[model samples]
Target: MKNVLIVDDERSFLSSVSEGLSAYAAEFNTLTAENGKKAIEILNSTQVDLVVTDLKMPEMDGFELLAYMSRQFPDIPVIVMTAYGTPEIKERVQSMRVSQYLEKPLDFKELVDKIFLELAASSEGYIRGITLPTFLQLVEMERKTCTLKITSKGRIGYLYFNEGQLIGAETETDKGEKAAYEIVCWEDAEIEIESICRRKHRNISTTLGHIIMEGFRLKDEKERAVEKENIIEVGIEETGEVDGEEEIILETLEKEEKMNTLKDILNEFTKLQSVTAVCLVGRDGFLLDSIARTGIDTEMVGAIASSGFGAAESMGRQLGKGELTMSMLEFENGPVMFSPVGENAFLVIVAEKDANLGMIRLKLKKHSHELAAVAAI
Candidate 1:
């Protein structure tokens, strides 16, 4: 069980919060305070693993508490729950490196997850540590604009950062987050913090773009394919016999051949002035194979893109809009390609500035139909 501290001015709110957390009764040992002064007194002596504090307290507010923690117990995770937030206060909290932030009328699910993440955070060596809600909320608060890209499984995606929040996203051939979501239908790794985006393009219609990528052209996440150290076994019989079924043999052979051929394509693309690498994923953004020059971690790329695909779909549904279709990504070194294979899959490609966009489009225009037909089979 972990020890926790709750500091708030409102009696009812404090009790309600305590009760909610106590529901997990056995997992956490909770302590409460009516004001920041009492909370500080408790912390000065007792050992508390986490703190759930309200922003505005009568005496000694959340900021004061944050300062206290920073000075004495920086390692202890602190989560700020507030109804109102100002730019100045938000900036101050960011600098403090608060573990997480919660906006009032607390989201129980989000809150629980935040706690879990804080608990799971490694105390020792860590390269990339992500405080989800805080980071995401900061982006929204600041309204910063940028692009965040990620890849996993065998797929890839592009997330558009607007005002420091996830405002939009897409794939190599799609226009918006919605289209990217549908094509890369991965079960996990779908959140924005771990998604994809390159150029942050806004002129294209995301839905149509995803459809075009999957239904019209067969593409893949070539530039970001994870280099597998060991050879993967594609297919085998029940008894580990490869001679049982002709169709199985053909299918296994096809997957391997495609991956190898795709590698060749990526190698050549990297050599071109405006070309990077190319990927051949399914209409659903399921990576079939890929090619790339730079050592891009394709597994992470595929997982992230798949989640982006899902988010795009969820956002579209919330808006009472249609499904996403295709998208694209532009990067400093090269551009990422997205082309659909069929109803359930799509493809992605990475290229440099000099890669012929017109030629790529023409090629996709011709191949997408065939790819979609195959996907249906």
Candidate 2:
């Protein structure tokens, strides 16, 4: 039996859905959460097949949860139920890769139908699966405005199309044109589409056809490099008569080197007294790395930052302005600044209320190129 997770602040609605699903859709079991935070906790502990969520809630809303899932559980399809069916909300949800969007006063049976349809389609054979490049081409040909959730290998990617023109793309730790290239190159990808495109500005200026062609070129180059490296490794292993443990040690050492590089960069940000927290968040809204003082929720901060940045960027586009370079949100007690570190990731800086914005921006600008290099690797 499949396990379905439902989230809403209304206890009565939650109870009704849980009981109704059991009675009407006997093939599935249900779990419930009062808000996004609780839903995330349940998701961490339980193995869930599908998520049905409401848009607005206290603490964490549907948008934040959707962003989180796009990174951590891209393979799972989500159905969004919202009382507010505004165009802006629809566009935002689409950009976040929601599987289905339904307005409030939802017909329970219709919701169940969407759930079962998504589950069934995902279970189909390899031949019937949606090919990532082909789907994008079709979207372009049809002039469809929608968001696509793509699962390739172990990563989840999101593609937003405005009237069939590719505008934005995102992955767990990447975004924009680079994310688009990486996503289309992966094999055996599964796709989920929801109509609506919220992104206003175009982060990927390249044509879709060109981007797809480039993706293929990159994939071919990567494969050739890997093959050459593997041949060299095999020859060395034969000559040295190395055991499995030695190979494991070499792999561990390589990983440690990468981690050290990331740590060194994070340490530099933490050294600032005005900075209370520094987090690197992927375009898909996942936390890549973070350093924080005590009493901070780094994961939540990353999620909120990703959403805020995307929304602001979209608004800029809609206004015929250029891409978003940096944004600052000031609260009563503190201020938060967000900036694009690279095409794939962003930096979120939390500082005291009286922190020096000018100095922080200057420092961030100075190290932006170095940070981008680190992020790319």
Whole-model lDDT, model 1: 0.55
- For model 1 the TM-score comes to 0.36
Q: Please write out the lDDT profile of model 1 over residues 174-254, one tens digit for every residue.
A: 655454444333322223332233454464343322433453233334322322211223344333664657466657665
CA lDDT of each prediction against the hidden true structure:
0.55, 0.73
Cα deviation of 309, candidate 2, in Å = 44
Candidate 1, which ten residues in sequence have the lowest lDDT sum? 223-232
Off by over 4 Å in 1: 84-97, 122-377
Estimated TM-score for each candidate = 0.36, 0.36
TM match of model 2 to true structure: 0.36
lDDT of 2 by residue, 264-298 (tens): 55776665535799888888789988899999999
Every candidate's CA RMSD: 18.1, 22.5
Tell me the lDDT of model 2 at 257: 48
